[model samples]
Target: MTAIDQSAVETLFTNARTHNVWKDKSVSEQTLRELYHLMHFGPTSMNCQPLRVLFLNSQAAKERLKPALMPGNQEKTMKAPVVAVLGYDTEFHEHLPRMFAHNKDAKSLFEGKTDFINTTAFRNSSIQGGYFILAARSLGLDTGPMSGFNNAAVDEEFFPDGKVKSNFLCSLGYGDHSSLFPRQARFEFDEVCRIL
Candidate 1:
């Protein structure tokens, strides 16, 4: 496959920033669906695509989510046009027969193994969340991924069934970059990576 143009690369990563301030623009339902359709193609180990998302767009939904947010996250999340409750399904293995057709034993491997199930679910879901952000950016949206929140409260409020668990919260919309904080420094590649 041909490499994507430099502008596309910049749109997805190089120039994308975590936006805490958003404009008054709303993210339509269609856009959210399209975003997920694109991000779902991102790979996961054993095809255990466990990440689940709840998009809070209405005022009532945001109010329900308010108590769960930490003070620092509350304001930005409340103002953003969309807040995605990124979650993972502990029972994701149940879908393995359909999702991992080649491996008939995939479901059996995770069904009785609590530790392995949790590890795989969390790891893969986290990777999918990264894909979600990039997918949103690719669609001309901005995202503010924040972890400063009460996970237990969020899980109870959003996924009370106990089947899914909250992973993180991401606020999405058109960003207001005029109020953005100065960009922070990142570690040099040599300091963070090694060629084997």
Candidate 2:
């Protein structure tokens, strides 16, 4: 495969910013669906796509999530065009038959293994969450992914069925660029990485 152009690279990574304040502009439903279609193709172990997203776009829906969010996250999340309640499915392995058809024994690997299931679900879904951010950026939308909220409260309020567990929340919309804080420092390759 060919390398993506630098412009696209900047769109997804280099110039992408995690927005806190959003503009009054709205994000279209069609764009949200397209975003999912693009991000779902990202790889997961055994192709178990465990990440389940709940998009809260209406005031009433956002209100339901209000109590779960920390004080600082409430205003920005409430005003953002979309707030995605990202979760991981506890029973995601049940779909392994269809997701990992090549391995007839795939389902058995996670079946009855509580610790294993939870770990796989959380790890793979978090990877998908990262893909979700890039996919939104590629679609020209701004993102704010944060974890300052209460997880238990979110799960009880949103995922009452007890199957999907709340992982994090991400706000999406047109950002108020002027309100952005200066970018923080990052570790250099030599500081955080090493060659064998």
Candidate 3:
């Protein structure tokens, strides 16, 4: 396959920045749905596709999420147009029969294996979270993904049934670029990768 245009690459990665401040614009529910539709195609092991999302967009919803957020994250989350609580389904394997249809025994690989289930759930959900960010950027939205929060508190508040577990929180909106810090540095390919 041919490479995507450089501008698309810039939108998804090079020019994208983690935004903490937001402009006074709202993210429509339709946009959120579109974003998920775009991101959900990212591949996962056994096609487990475990990521689940809860978006806080109202004052009451933000207030309910407040106590679970870290002090440093509370203001940004409340002010952002949308705060996405990204999580994973504990029973994600139950869907393997349909999602991993090529392999009828896919669910059996995870069933009754507590440690394996948790690891797969977290790992695949994290992979999907990366897709979520890129999809948002491609749609001209800004993202601020942060992990400074109480996992148990979030799970209790939003996933009381214990069927899902929170992984991270990401704020989505039109970013306030005036307040952005300078872009940070990264290591060269050789510094972090190896050819086998």
lDDT of 2 by residue, 39-87 (tens): 9999999999999999999989999999988998899889999999999
The order of the candidates by lDDT, greatest first, is 2, 3, 1
Distance from true position, residue 143, model 3, in Å?
Answer: 0.2
Across 68-182, the per-residue lDDT of candidate 3 in tens digits comes to 8889888988999999999999899999989999998899998899999999999999999999999999899999999999999999999999999999999999999999999
- Pairwise TM-score winner, candidates 1 and 2: 2
Over 4 Å off in model 2, which ranges?
A: none
Tens digits of lDDT, candidate 1, 1-196: 9999999999998999999988999999999999999999999998899999999999789999999888877888899999999999999999999999999898999878989988999999999999999999999999999888898998998889998999988999999989888889999999999999
**Candidate 2 local lDDT, residue 77:** 88
| Top candidate by TM-score | 2
Candidate lDDT (C-alpha), each: 0.93, 0.95, 0.94
Q: What is the C-alpha RMSD of each candidate to the true structure, in Å?
A: 0.7, 0.6, 0.8
* True-vs-predicted CA distance for residue 38, candidate 1, Å: 0.4
**Residue 25 miss distance in model 3 (angstroms):** 0.3
| Candidate 3, superposed: residue stretches over 4 Å from native | none
